[model samples]
Target: MNFYAIKAIYLFEMSRTFRTITQSLLAPVISTILYFVVFGSAIGSKIQTIEGISYGVFIVPGLVMLSVLMQSITNASFAIYFPKFIGTINELLSAPVSTLDIIIGYIGAAATKSFSIGILILLTAHLFVPLNIIHPFYMISFLLLTCFTFCLFGFIIGLWAKNFEQLNLVPMLIITPLVFLGGSFYSISMLPLFWQKLSMFNPVVYLISGFRWTFFNVSDFSFTISLIATISFATLCLIIIFYMFKTSYKIRT
Candidate 1:
């Protein structure tokens, strides 16, 4: 339905990405390489293996997840927030596109960008460390789900934000901290028992754990739990977005 409308919006967003190639794509890739240099060289030397996987290799999934999560949120939030900031959202609102169509256009483009970044980072990882993927199917599944879910969450952020500062608030303050503490650089098992239990409450842990499991069949939580948590979070974001669009929250005004 309204395929043409979706295509126009999608193309517009994609073109903007190309225009900002340095920031949108290259920046994250460069940052990830730095992480490899610092963590893989300095820290990886001290800690040889976590669950029998080399420290450098062990962190690959986490690093990719970190980049993907942040980029997904950044891309989606900015895509819609720019429209709101410049007063062009009203034009899109008046278009014949349904809410789903609009969401698909924006969210799809954002997810695609993040997904491409994920693939690029994975390929880049090979240059630094020898890597192995035990279950490629599950790895791709988790990557796709994470991209779509976070992009949707970012879209919600775009809608709720009234200013630029507010737009950066969640990803920088909340999500970024959660990721670092969520076992991105080390396993939660390395934590003391109490902290290990406490780590369970941080949602990003499950995401990184589940993705790591796909690579080495190792994780802080059960694979089943991780999958459920990922899907549940996605579903929750979808519900909130549906309600927002239906009520015209921050869109109609």
Candidate 2:
């Protein structure tokens, strides 16, 4: 792997992000504020506290996760997809850059963008509700882990997608719906026993619950279980992504 090549790719990607900084960063922040205003202030007043934390505060982790999840996916997908669209991907492929270098370059930028946005959203939430971090280390760890895993998953989506419409399909359709139904705004305890069992199938539930535990020191499920699920899911996603990269699936004939 060439150091110069890696640096070139990273700097180029970062430049592209800078060109549209407002849409990438500020728009997400604005949407997050709207959520705080509408849901936290308007709807939450009618709801009681969860684990001694106000409904608004309880939703903070989920909001952070939402920001990280979307940013990671969109950043990674667009990074690769645009190269393919502009005929630059073939140049990189034919260049001396190894596939590992390519993956690291793209995923690193995506994670960085996602992490920055996640923290920004958390900071923005501070204006609306005072948040308490019962476990700061765990909170940061989960946030990074979530960002890394989704970035890898998005890379796979980028490689597999054949067009712009296909690229946005998974995030807009699958990921968004999963997050909403994953108890981001509500607790599964409010659900009946049957629905509670069903909710377990949604992987985002573990992520949201784990993040909530970091803030309130209370969780719907064991914190250890969430850690294990996150680790396992990330590992599986990495394996699949590595395989795709190694095989050059959908990248070459």
- The local lDDT score (0 to 100) that residue 87 gets in candidate 2 is 83
Please write out the lDDT profile of model 2 over residues 34-82, one tens digit for every residue.
Answer: 9998889899899888667789998888888887888899999888988
Candidate achieving the largest TM-score: 1
User: lDDT per residue, candidate 1, 75-165, as tens digits?
Assistant: 9999999999999998998898898898899999999999999999999999999988999999998999999999999999999999999
lDDT score of residue 8 within candidate 2 = 86
Model 1 bad stretches (over 4 Å): none
What is the lDDT for 217 in model 2? 85
Residue 157 in model 1: lDDT: 99
- Write down the worst ten-residue block by lDDT for model 1: 20-29
